[model samples]
Target chain A: MHEMSLCENILQTLQQQANAQQYSKVKTIWLEIGELAGVEADALRFSFDSVMQDSIADQARLEIIDIAGQAYCSHCAKNVPIQQRYDACPECGHFPLQIVAGDQMRIKQLEVE
Target chain B: MCGICGCGEGHTHSHEEDHSHDSLDHDHHNPIDGHQHAAQHTHAQGLSPARMVQIEQDILAKNNAYADENRRYLSQRGILALNLVSSPGSGKTSLLTETIKRLKEELSIAVIEGDQQTTRDAERIRATGVPALQINTGKGCHLDAHRVGHAFEHLALSDHSLLFIENVGNLVCPSAFDLGEAHKVVILSVTEGEDKPIKYPDMFHAADLMILNKTDLLPYLDFNSAECIAYAKRVNPKIKVLSLSAKTGEGMDNWLKWLKAELELQRIDYA
Candidate 1:
């Protein structure tokens, strides 16, 4: 799975932040993963522990924040919730809704010393 | 393969320990009266308490940076680079071989083949009298921008040439990583399930064009071409589509025309 790659990316971000923030130890990490990001939270959590071993974030706890998919329905002229990319507009039953959010993977914040 | 850096072939998280912990002796000092009396400073007084640092950084920022560099590199030289993605056994290699055979006589064609192992695809492309390079990703599912940038160093690409990057045969992971291509052409054979577009919407959504290959085999199969196209359009309203068979040269003229038009457009935009 690509979750391993995403985990490595998370560790690299942590290292870069450690340099700028001067935090020798990272206690907990808060990751924001979107619904359409195609990342499984369980797989990411399983890889996070091994990926962070022996690094500054060793033994750190991972906190994943789930984000719901949001889109703008041009047919209905309103914002609607979409669980997937091909989801039709709930109000007008139209295809091709412009995606507004919930397709991003970002490191929101970290608790460190 | 190392997914983040693409350094080693089939290498895991194995490395020599280099982290030193020589700066964690907070039990010996007392800031109040300069006395090590009871060895009991549960919370270090002078040290700042743990705080939350705000870092709203995109996870794919690094990959995107590399992709941008590649885009600039290709644009400056007026190169028409296309990233072809598909599932296994989708006739991507056959399509490339056929396309190269048709265009190599008039243009400089090059290919970069990606697979977990083996150089057969590259060999096949090279047999068409064109330069080709094979990248063995060994256990890696997708090719990132960093590895593709590294591949550019070895390829003696000329100005105004066509470069095709055949991504690893996977419909899932490769959609997320942009390799600085002018367009992503996803090849879907009719042998696969018709519901693939709905099942793997992310890939179809990221693609600029979808090629419905193996039209010759449509007579024997129960695959409905109209429904498949509709499903793809449902996911990506702007994605251009072409139906072709890379073997019998059926509907290939449309694909070649599209490529030539895109190359001409790139030249005009760069000029």
Candidate 2:
């Protein structure tokens, strides 16, 4: 929902890491986005170019890694795959499950010069 | 848990240019500063090879850090801060004022009201004789933890008090940003569609409690209370629901009771 601000966050991180990692320009950024992370990939891509304008990572290509959602359903006593945050256990019709994975929105890697 | 995490609110990235990159060959202005020229090398073509740098950091890590600081500050003092989130016109202000009016005499009550461009909610809160501070987010869709941290420094929050943060009338963005609140209470008025829980399932799923406000008009409208709670539970089975009419003062005792219980829990957690 706040993709523009998120892009700005990426820019900030790129600038910070530039000092620590010693990179002048960012060629690409690989982000690991999970299904339940509540970020729209299209919106993020649309905002990336505008938010990174004239910055260190300006015109950087975005690579998104899709991660499916997984949760531990106690009723089934196993981790199950799910698409939505409110999804019941696919195996046992459990109303709620402990989210075990796929809630991440992270910057996994960056290609720099 | 670093206390300095919230210092970014006043930070300027101008220091980024001051860092002496190894490519300090430029007499004054360095154009290729963004590209980390880590190795001091003389490339024949003046081009650096592209290489992968692993970051593996959460996008919201900075904000989460600030939230952690705020949470530590509040929890250490035995304060119970609740983030009230909902779509526009969910009676969040009314419920807040009513909640304050009921408990102001017994507890130290304070408020932080967030809106796009108005202090009116804060004014309403202050009219109840409780201290209130207003945060104008301007174009922001929600209140972040950094701003909440600043507000915390300004407000005179005594120990073992109740802090109510009325977030900007947004259900989507606020669900993602934690403002160091003890719990997120999503309020949905019957006047709005009951299908909200399913329509915005992320908010429903993130909220620990769901307040079904404006139940006083339940008889006037065809608002089905049963289905609404069912949908909320379907979305979040552990979510607790409390039906109340903030305007009519009905079902407020249960709300107050819940507050006291949470305050007690906060005390136990602190001890």
Candidate 3:
């Protein structure tokens, strides 16, 4: 699964940050997985636990904040929550809308001691 | 009962008064019984309430940075990279072989073949007399931007070049990661049925082009090309659909024409 690879990237970033800050232990890791990012939260968490065992993030709690997909309706000129990419705007029934947010994967913050 | 320190021992261990554990009384089990120990264990082993709210980050930010670097590199080189995604035995290699044979004379083409094992696809492309590199993913389901960056090091890509990244034979996981491709082409064979686009809409939705491969087999199979195109359009209206048989060279003219046009456009943009 790509979740494993994603977890590896997370661990790499966490390690870099920890090394830079000289943090002895990481208490928690905050992640924002977007709805259209195509990453499963449960699968990522499972893979993170397995991959982080020998790393700086060992025993670190993974906090996933799932962001809902949002689209800017070109026709309606309104922002709307998008469940799927091809979904018509709830207000104006537009066919093609520009995705404004919720297609992202980012590390927001890290709690460390 | 000093609240400043979670004092189990007599010595006061207080240092930072700013760090205080927020007590929410998350006791799910009987607090009176010794079973509270079991509940505490569950809470500690699982997600801590305090730890949950503090972290709100995207885990793939690092990968996204690498992907952005790859995009910059490809754009600087003026290379139109295409990531071809499909299931195994979907004739991706055959389609690439045909495309190379048709376009090799007119264009500077290079290929990066991704497979779980073996350099079979790379060898196939090399047979067409073009520079090719094989990336054995080694249990990886999809090729990421970093792996692609590594592959790009081996290829001699110049301005106005065409680079094709034949992703690992998977429709699901490969659709998730962007390999710094200018366009993503999802190929569906006629033998896979018309419902494939609907079943794997993520791949269809992510793709810029939908290639309906193996039209010669359509007579024996129950695939309706029109319905397949309709389904793909429903998911992604902007996606261009082309039906072609890589085997018999049927409808290949249109495929080659599209490539030529894209290459010309890219050359102009680069200039």
Candidate 4:
């Protein structure tokens, strides 16, 4: 799964932060994954432990923050919560909503030693 | 703002920005005792005093760095790079071979074929008398910008050339990794279900152009062309669609024209 590669990216970020923050080990990581980011949290969790093996963040707890999907409705001219990319506007029922937010995959913060 | 790490709320960084060790000053906070010996140190509730470090960085930052580098390199040389993505048996290799055969004489063309383990695609492209590099991902599902950048070096692409990066035969993972291409051209064969757009929304949404390949087989299949287009439009309103068959060269002119338009656009921007 691509979640393996995503976890590798997370591990790299953790290593960089560990060096910058002068921490020998990481306790927990808070990853902000949006609902529309196309990343499966379960897949990421499954690959996290193996990907973090022998790294500075070995055995670090991965706490994912699920961000809600949001889109800008052109018809309604309002921001609406959407579950899928092709979701219509909740109010106007218009198709092809412009995505304004909730498609980000970012490392928010880390709980480290 | 803090005298320790220079990381504040307003701090913004590019993908290529090097984040060196900031060397946090632990001298004031018990030095070795603060940095180490944290496993044994517990708070009032027996909770580890784990410090929270704010790092609002994109997870794709590393891959984006390589992608940015590739974009610059290609743009500087006026190379029109397109990433071709599709599922297995979508005739991505056949499309490239056919395209190269048609365009290699008029324009400098090269290809980078990606697969889990196969040089066959690259060999096929090379058989068309165009330079092709095979990137065997070796269990990797997608080609990252880093690997593409490395492949670019070996390709020795000419100025104002066309580079096609035929990604691994998977619709899901390749949509996420940006290989520094000018555009991502996703090819969907008619033999596949017409509801593929909705089934793989991420790929369709990320794609700039969707090529409905193998249109020659439409007569025998139940694939609804209009419905497929409609589904694709639902996810990406701005996505351009073109139906073509790499085998019989049906609607190849339109595909070639699209390539020419992109090349011309790249030249204009370079100018």
Candidate 5:
């Protein structure tokens, strides 16, 4: 829902990193967004275009890497993949599992020159 | 106009006066035009193509850094800061005003009210005779850590005091932004659906305590208390639940007790 602000943050990061990284324009940006991050990939992509337009990453490509939500269920005794935080364990039907992974929004890499 | 794309928006650079990306064939050398924008893209030295740069940085790292600063500031001073989050019309301000009225004399209380475009919440808070700062987020949906830090600078909060950060009335967006609060207290009113916990699981999961407000209206509505608590547990097993009505003050005492306990704990920790 706040994808626009998120895109602006991405642009700011790109610009700040440009000085040290020795790059003028960003060619592609790869983001790892988890299902539990409360971010929609399509919404982020849509916001990326406007936020990046006319900037150093103008016309840049945004590649989102989807990270599946994983949580450890004591009943299952293992990590299980679920879509939402409130989802019940697929194997044991127990919910509110201990979250082990996902819920991350990070800039993994950038193709710059 | 951008010489590369002809987009008449950005500031025109001297080197890019007539430079076109299509005509670039190692034009680093002067081509009668001394204004060369070759520095726009730094030379790759040995690499011939675009190189991959590993960042592995959190997108919210800047905000998180600011939040960490706020956390350090509050924790060092033994200030108990609570971030109050809920949907619009969920009685967050009302509950805060009510809580302030009860605890203002006993506790050194301050408030930071956040809204998209109003000082209304802050006004309500100040009427309780406690120092309150209003942060109008403008187009922003949530109160960011940086903004909160600025507001904190202006508010004269005493040591061992309680700072209540009434965040923008948004459940989904505010769930992600941490405002350096000791805990996130989500106020869920019975007027809203009991299925809210499941629908907005991120907020329920992130929150440490869930306050079921407007219990006074529970008798007239079909809101099921048990089902709401169950759903909240389904999302967050460790989430503490408290049911109360800010209007009638039916269970406000419990909420007050919880706040006092947290404040005392912080004082102990600070000592």
Candidate 6:
């Protein structure tokens, strides 16, 4: 799964941040995973646990905040919550709506000590 | 006012006190050993709570950087790169074989076949007398930008060349990463329902062209060509849709024409 690779990147970023700040332990990690980011939250948590073993974040708590997918409906002239990219607006049946938000995947904050 | 630390006139002293209280609270709650607690306190002061917000860095930044580099590399070599995405057993190898057969005489073609394991697809492409390299992702669900970069090293791309990267049989994860291709062509066989574009819209949204493969088998299946096209068009209005049967060679002329047009477009850009 791509989650494992993403976990590896997370670990690398964590290691770099910890080294830069001279922190020996990371207590909690707040991650923002968007609904439309195509990444599974459970799978990412599972992989994070497996990949962070013996690393600085071994006992770290992962707090994942799921962002709802939002889209700008061209025909409706309003923002709509989109479950899938091609989903038509509930208010107006419009194809090819532009995505406004909810494709984000980022580490929001780290509680390190 | 220091932007990095967020320490203004009235906030500096209180911020230090609040920082100390936070570390003290952490020590009271977790109760780590003396040495570790001391080490943590030193670093804890530097942790501004403002770092929590406005860190608008994209998570896919690393992959996008690699993809940008790949685009530059491909541009320098004057190669028109296409990333082919589809479900497993969707006649990708067959399509590649037929495409290579048609274009190898007039165009320089190279292939990078991605699979979980095996060189079978590469072997099939090589049979057409074109150079093909196999990238076994080794249990990976999809190919990333870095892997494609590595594959480019072994490919001998010349001026006015075509390079096809057959991504691992996946419709989801592959859409999230850009491989620096001029076009992303997604194939859906007739056997796979017409509603696939609606079900997996990310792939359809990312795709520049959609090919309804295995059209020869349509009589045996319950697929309605019009419905499939409608679904794809609904998802991505700009997607060019083509129906073809790699087995019976039906509707291949359209595919060939699209390829030739892409090559000509690349030539025009180079000119």
Candidate 3 chain A least-lDDT 10 residues? A16-25
Could you tell me how far off, in angstroms, the CA of residue B252 lies in candidate 5 after the best superposition? 1.1
Best-fitting candidate, scored by DockQ: 2
Clashing pairs for model 2 are A22-B36, A23-B35, A23-B36, A24-B34, A24-B35, A24-B36, A25-B34, A25-B35
DockQ of candidate model 1? 0.48
| DockQ for all models | 0.48, 0.53, 0.22, 0.45, 0.48, 0.25
Task: Kindly list the per-residue Cα lDDT of model 6 for residues A1-113, writing each as its tens digit.
Answer: 78887776677666546546656667788888888887888899889898777777787888999899888887888999888777778778776677788878898877765
Per-residue lDDT over B127-174 for candidate 2, one digit per residue giving the tens place of the 0 to 100 score: 999888888776678887877876776576999999999888988888
How many angstroms is residue B194 displaced in model 1 relative to the true structure, after the best TM-score fit?
A: 1.6
Q: For candidate 1, what is the DockQ-based docking class?
A: acceptable
Could you give candidate 2's per-residue lDDT for residues A7-113 as a string of tens digits?
76677778778878867788999999999988899999998999787787888999999999999988888899999877888888986788888989999999987
> What's the number of clashes in each of the models?
1, 8, 8, 0, 0, 0
C-alpha TM-scores of all predictions? 0.87, 0.86, 0.78, 0.87, 0.87, 0.82
Backbone clash pairs for candidate 1 read B1-B10
Give Cα distance to truth, residue A34, candidate 6, Å: 1.7
Residue-wise C-alpha lDDT for candidate 1, range A19-104, written one tens digit per residue: 57767677999988999888899999998998788777889999999999999998788889999999998888987899898999
Residue-wise lDDT of candidate 5 within B69-166, one digit each (tens)? 78888888999999999999999999999999999889999998888876778888888899888777667788877667656655867999999998
What's model 6's lDDT at B20? 32
Sum up the clashes in candidate 3. 8
Instruction: Write model 1 residue lDDT over B148-196, tens digit each, in one string.
Output: 7766755768988999999999999999899989999999999997888
Q: Once all C-alphas are superposed, what RMSD does model 4 give against the true structure?
A: 9.5
Q: How large is the interface RMSD of each prediction?
A: 9.6, 3.7, 11.0, 6.1, 6.6, 6.6
Angstrom error of the Cα, residue B119, model 6: value is: 1.1
